[model samples]
Target: MRVVIAGGHGQIALRLERLLAARGDQAVGIIRKVEQAADLRDSSAEPVVLDLETAEPAAVAEVLEGADAAVFAAGAGPGSGSARKDTVDRGAAALFAEAAQRAGVRRHVQVSGMGLDRADDPGMDEVFSAYLKAKAAAEDDLRARDLDWTILRPGRLTDEPGTGQVHLADSVDYGTISRDDVAAVLVALLDEPRTVHHTLELVEGHTPIDEALKRI
Candidate 1:
């Protein structure tokens, strides 16, 4: 399978690329900078340099051509303000879905966060609030599309080693999940046809990854 990941240079995206490559699957990463291409190459993911924020849907679709699946993993990062939140978080995700449809790729997986649908109070930091709102909008756009989609909302992400175990549910209390584990889950979701059209929440748990996805 050929998988295309937006924000290809992201921590989780890179991990996912490595996992796909190890399994003899092709991983394509969409990056904005040329320097990031090397990192993707090292991970065995083909890098396509294109800025989703500025690129039109047709341009993005060109990169997505002949791909099996597309993953919207891009973000504006923590340091940016609320304006960027709208552009990269919400807008970019919507654009990716549009390009996917135009490219005729039916499968898409989104990396979203938990509590985005209900978190309306970003009083202390309007930026964080805006981030959640953008994510929620992105989710709405993907759901509206005519594509095979699975949204994975993971709790606080950590850099700890992956346990290959997770608690997958439609709703769950707050908890932390390793980035590696999240990547593993993404790969599993891509392979699990039953996961189509489902929105799942993930966190650390005793059950292994495959079993957790099966239960979901």
Candidate 2:
């Protein structure tokens, strides 16, 4: 399979690229900086320099053309304020989905976050609230699209090694998940067409990754 990923330089994306490559699948990563190309090459992923925040949908579609699947894994970093949360999280995500449609790519996987239900809670930090709202808006937009889309909302992410175990379901209590485990699950989701149109929550658990996906 040939998969194109937005935010190719992100932690999860990089790990995913390596996994795909190791499995003999082609991986293309969209990055804004030319400097990141080497890293993608090291993972055996083709790197395309494009800034989703400023690029038109048609331009992005050009990059996505002939791709088997697309993954939206972009995000504004922790240091960024609320404005970027809207631009990158919500706006960029919407743009990527539109591009996928234009390119005739039917399968899409969106990397979202848990706890979006609390986006409107007054107790949350202002920027965090905005971030959640952006992610939630992005999820709504993807659900309304004419595509085979699966949304994975993973709980607090960590850099710990993957245990190859997880809790995957339509809904689950909030918990933490390793980035490695998240990438592994994404690979399984890409190969499982039965998961289309489902929104799943993921976190660390006893069930093995493949078994967890089978239960989905």
Candidate 3:
């Protein structure tokens, strides 16, 4: 399978690329900076320099051509203001989903946050409200598109080494999950089409990651 990943420079994105390559699947990373291409060479991924924030849908779809699946993993990290959060997180994701449809790619996946209930949470919203809102919007947009989509909403991300065990369910806990574990789940979902059209929340758990994904 050929997978095209948006925001390929992210730590989690790179991990996913490595996992895909290890499985003999092709991974193309869409990066914003030309220099970022060099980083992907060591990870066995081809980097396509493209900015999701400003690129047109047609241009984005061109990069997605011949891809078996497209994963929306781009986001504006810390130091980005609220405006950029909407533009990159929500707008870019939405555009990517639409472009994937235009390119006739049926398989799509999005990396979202766990606390995206769309309810009014006073304390947490104030701290990461923009991020939550953007994730919610992106999920909703993907759900409305014409594709076999799976949205994986992960808990607070930790940089700790992957435990290879996780909780996958409809209702989520706000526990921390490793980026490596999330990448493992993403690759698992690609092979299991039954996970399509389902939005699952993921976090570290007692069961093994492969077993948890099989149950999904």
Give the winner by TM-score.
2
- Rate residue 103 of model 2 by lDDT: 100
- Separately for all candidates shown, the number of backbone clashes (residues 3 or more apart, or on different chains) is 0, 0, 0
Query: What is the per-residue lDDT of model 3 for residues 103-145, given as tens digits with 9 covering 90 to 100?
Result: 9989999998876764467666453688778888899899998
Ten contiguous residues with the weakest lDDT in model 1: 117-126
Model 3 TM-score relative to the real fold = 0.95
Each candidate structure's TM-score, on Cα atoms with residue i matched to residue i, is 0.98, 0.99, 0.95
**What are the RMSD figures for all models against the true structure?**
1.0, 0.6, 1.4
Which residue segments of model 3 deviate by more than 4 Å?
Answer: 123-127
Candidates ranked by lDDT, best first?
Answer: 2, 1, 3
Off by over 4 Å in 2: none
lDDT of 1 by residue, 1-216 (tens): 999999999999999999999999999999999999999999999999999999999999999999999998999997999999999999999999999999999999999999885657635468888899999999999999999999999999999999997899888888999999999999999999899999999999899999988887
Q: How big is the positional error of residue 72 in model 1, measured in Å on the Cα after superposition?
A: 0.8
Q: Is candidate 2 or candidate 3 better by TM-score?
A: 2
Q: Which 10 successive residues of model 3 have the least lDDT summed?
A: 118-127
What tens digits encode model 2's per-residue C-alpha lDDT throughout 1-216? 999999999999999999999999999999999999999999999999999999999999999999999999999988999999999999999999999999999999999999998977868999999999999999999999999999999999999999998999999999999999999999999999989999999999999988888887
Task: List per-prediction Cα lDDT, in the order shown.
Answer: 0.94, 0.96, 0.89
**Among these predicted structures, which one has the highest lDDT?**
2
Poorly placed runs, candidate 1 (over 4 Å): none
